[model samples]
Each structure stands twice: as C-alpha cells, then as structure tokens.
Target: MADEPKTPVPESPPAPAVAKKAAAAKPAATAAAAGNDAKLAGRTTTAAARRPKKAPADDDTSPLMGRRGWMGLAWGAFTAANAGCLAATGRFMFPNVLNEPPQQFTVGFPDDYGIGVDERFKDTQGVWIVRTESDYTHEAPGFYALFSICTHLGCTPNWLSAENKFKCPCHGSGFRPTGINFEGPAPRPLERTRIALAEDGQILVDKGQKFQEELGGWADQDSFLQT
Candidate 1:
C-alpha cells in the first residue's frame, strides 16, 4: 500500500480567534507585571524607612562674639567715651560767660547820710562818706568819699572817734578826719574814689576810678559830685 495518504490536519482556528485569545492572555500578564512592580516599590519604601538617620552637626556660630560684631561694639564704646571726655574738656576750657556787677555801684541818695563822716560803708565797701565845710566858716559845704584802705600797707584804718582820727591796727598808721596821713609809715594821704549823680537821683560811686592827692587827681572834676 503506498504511503497512506497524509490526512491534512484540520486547519488551525482563524487568525481572528487566535488574536482574541492572545489579547485575553495579554491582560492577565500585564496585571501580574503591574502587581510585581507595586510590590517592588513597596519593598524599596520599607528599606528607606529602616535606615538609621544621621546625627545633626554642632552649631559653632555665636551671636555677640562674632568677628566684626564684638570689635564694632568695642570701637563704638571707645569712641563714645572719648567724645564725652572731649566735650567735658571743651566745657571746662571755655566755660559759659557770666555778667557780673560793674566797678561802679549805686550808694543811694546823698540825703540819707549825716553831716559828718559816714562809716556805714567802712566795713562793707571800704570807703567813708564825709560831708564837711569847704572853709572854716562852715558856709560852703561839700561831700567827699575817703578810701578806708591805709596808704602804708593797704590795710583798713579804723575810725577812732575817741582820738578824733583814723588809726591802723596793723602798722600804727594814723589819718585825720580829712584823710590826711599825719603819722606812721603812710607815705601819702588816703585816696578818694570818683563820684557822680545818676539820673534816678542816686549817688554813683566808681571805685575803679580813684583820685590821689599826691598825683594831683584831686583837681579832677570827676573826683566828687556837687550836691
């Protein structure tokens, strides 16, 4: 018998059926692959969580002791102290100006005094106010101020009413009621200060401007003011 006739096997299913089965198998495979990827990602996340964390580093920065911070503070303090010292020195060197009384002062009215020597200003002003007659007849009267300072050593001479003269307690210098040095080491007569009348009817005495009989200053019209 010759080779049995090869029975042609039934033809495989159509390509469409095969394609459909393949498509169905592809979905299951893709599901399995996605599950495996999800598991791997979960494992990686667990490993990261199990790792030990690193310790924090120590901080070395200081707030006040920084390089320029402290240095700038010290410099500022030094400059402020120096400035205060300079200001104090300047104030001491050139102090504030003051207005003091002048050498000329008011001694009140002429009628306030008596006829003879007025010793009211002796201890206070170092001067004596004397109202005397120009002549022995006692007709023409004039007023004069006699400096109480002794001519010998610039000491104050006390008026001795008992002795009728002015006597120095320091050098024994004596002066008459008219301010004439009669005894002791006094070289000249006592000096007289300038006198003037103020607009307010007060007697103005200028102690800075004095008249000395030895220097012919008594002839000056400013030596005394006419009442």
Candidate 2:
C-alpha cells in the first residue's frame, strides 16, 4: 500500500476593501444607535414636563362633600316624613248626617231675632242659631232660616255679630245677614229652611228640606197652627 499523503489546509483569501470598510463603520453605527436612544429619552422627559398635573375637586384638607349638599339631603328627608304624617291623620273622623233633621222646631218672633244679630234661638235645634234684627210682623217680609253648614268646608258655622256675618269654623267662609255667601271659599248661601207659624204664635222650621234664594221663609198667619 502506498504511504498516504497529508492534505494541507487551504489559506483564506484577503478580505475585500468593502468588507473592511463595513467592519470599521460598526462602532459608528453603534454610537449612532446610543445617540438615538438618548434623544428618545430626552423627548420623553420634555413631554412629561409639558403635561399638566391633575388636581382635586375640593381643597386638599377639605371634606369631599359640601355643607349645602348635606343640608339639602336633610331637608328632603324631613319633608317626606311630614307628608307621611299628614296623610295618616286624615284617614277617619267624619260621620255623615243621619236621620231626618228635626222638624217642628220653634223660634222666637222677628222681634227677638231683629237687627240685633244672631240671637241663637232658645231651643235644641238652634244649637248655633243666628238671628238678624228685623220685625217680620207687617214689614217688607224678608226672612231666613238656615243650617250652620260651612260653605268652604263641612264644619259648623258661627254667627259673627260684631262683624255682622256668618263665619265657618273650619276655613273662614263668611255669609251675609240674609244667609248669602259673601266671603271666603263659599260658593253659595247657607241653605234656608221650610218654616211655619204654630198655633201658639211660635215659628216652626222644617230642617229636612233646604230652600235657596227665598224672599221669606214659609209663614201663613191665619193658617199658622193646624185647624
């Protein structure tokens, strides 16, 4: 067998000029990258400086809520409570008039009820009676007999003699001497009654029927009492 000859390693060719130039520029490229990073960092810092800081809605040491806001909340609660209370109280307490109003009710002659103003008759039905001065003996024949119901509300009415009017106890409705509504929430006059003269010369009023705008209450002298 012939002795094996050893193969020698081939020598590398000389680097190209362009390749050497690229190697030399590596450091400059790295430096340029570092400079670009530095410039980016500076720009970031400038932008942060230009942006405004966020502030709080209220003073630094003050509470988040204001006094007015608290007071408004409190008043709203109170008003709601008051309204509930009133609604509860008005639920009951009024009984409608029952049975027929009393009849054959006696009243004094006009001599007693004249211009003097509301002389509550001396009878049970006349609990809150008001009489005006004017003798109905042989005069112009104008008279009235009415229930003391308030025109504005359902409360009982009272005769205000000094003021010469009938006034409601509830909401201040008023009426004239002839039972005519004159003031306050009254829409009409106090209802007048059906009247008659009894045998004993006493005036009797039928409280059942209500007559409005009558010049004179029922009065027949000769047929006063039953035959």
Candidate 3:
C-alpha cells in the first residue's frame, strides 16, 4: 500500500492560555466585588454607630417633678382640703360664747361708806356708792348707787375728789356727786342702780334694775337705800 499523502493539521490557538487568563480575570473581579462589599458593610456599621439613640419617656426623665413627687403633692392637697372641711364642720357644730359678769352683786355694809362718793366699786362693779346726808330729789338721808358710765356717749367717768365731780375723759362731760349732769355734752343725768340692804347687812346692788333721772325713775324706793 502506497503511503497516503498526509494533510497538514492546523495548530489550535493557545486556548489553555486564554482560558487561564479568563480564569485569572474572573478571580480578580470576584476579589474586587468582595472588597466593595466589605467597604459597604464597614460604612453601614459606622453610620449605625454614629446615629443618636432615642431618649427615655417623659415619666422616667421629667425635668420638673417626678411622677412620685406629683402624686405626693396631689395627696397632700387632698389631705389639706379634708382638714379644712373638718375644721369648718367643727366650727359650725360648736359656736363661740361670750362670758359676761353677773348683773347683781353685793357691796359692803352702809357703815363702810362715808358721807361722800365711794368709788370702791366703780371699776369692779361699774357703780359708785354715794352716801348722802340728804338727797336732792328724795329729800332724805340715804345711800344710792350711780352708774359710772357717762350719759353723753357711754364712756366711763373718772371721779375727781378735788373737783367733787365725775369727769368723762372722752367728751369732757361733768357730773355732780349725785349723778346730775353739770357740764359738757351730757344729754341727761347719770343712771341709778337698785340699792337695797341684804339680809346679812351688806349693800345689795342690782344693775338689772336701772333708774333714769330724766324719766322720773329715781323716785322709786328701790333706787335708794335709807341708812
């Protein structure tokens, strides 16, 4: 058999070299992508770390008064209101009372007083015991109690021994020893209280029974005590 003429085989181009280059470029691209992802993850972490945190609620971080403090203040106000109401109720239940002196009282005996104005009971009993040799209106020797109040404006009169008169410091009203108005703004004579002798010989003065000279009440027998 004659040798067949051999055809020249074409040499394949460097496919392995091209494939290796492609493989190497793919790995580089993957590495570049990985680096970009790593950089993005780092940026995200930094941004998250830099962001501000949220604040607590108002009840937990209030600037003025805490929740417990506000509650305590409300309770204190309620207690004070209750106390005030209780005080008002108590005041309504029990009212105020005024203590006044007795209207009837006893002085000393007739012999203890001289034949002049006795001012011993003036400050304490609001009366002046006058023992007279003869009364101007009754025309008899007796003892009478004159109220120490002035007839002008109800002011207390001071007995002046040197002047022999009752002088009111308020309006300068003057009264005689017998309680007769003598000078200054007195509308009428002084009033007389009931004078009597007690069972024990003491002078019993009853302020509840009053006698006015202008009203002719001095003529009553109870207005004077005969010594």
Which model scores highest in lDDT?
3
TM-score-superior candidate, 1 or 3: 3
CA error at residue 23 for candidate 1, angstroms:
94
lDDT by residue (tens digit), candidate 2, 1-227:
99999999997756797698889999999999999888787356767888998875663443765767777889999999999888777655555667865565777664555433455652457433334334233233434566666656667777776797778877778887667787888887766666666577666666666655433432333211221
Q: What's the lDDT for all of these models?
A: 0.81, 0.62, 0.91
- Deviation in Å, model 2, residue 162 alpha carbon: 1.1
lDDT of 1 at 111: 85
Clashes of 3: 0
TM-score of each: 0.57, 0.42, 0.69
Q: List residue ranges in candidate 3 displaced over 4 A.
A: 1-63
lDDT of 1: 0.81
Give the number of the best model, judged by TM-score: 3
lDDT of 1 by residue, 1-227 (tens): 67877878888898999999999999999999999888787365766789999888535488646667777999999999999999988888886888755667778898887667788877777788877766122235666788888999898888888898899999999988778889999999899888888899988778898888889787677776665
Show where candidate 2 strays beyond 4 Å. 1-101, 109-113, 126-139, 214-227
For model 1, what is the alpha-carbon lDDT of residue 227?
59
- Candidate 1 residues lying further than 4 Å off, grouped into runs, are 1-88, 96-101, 135-140
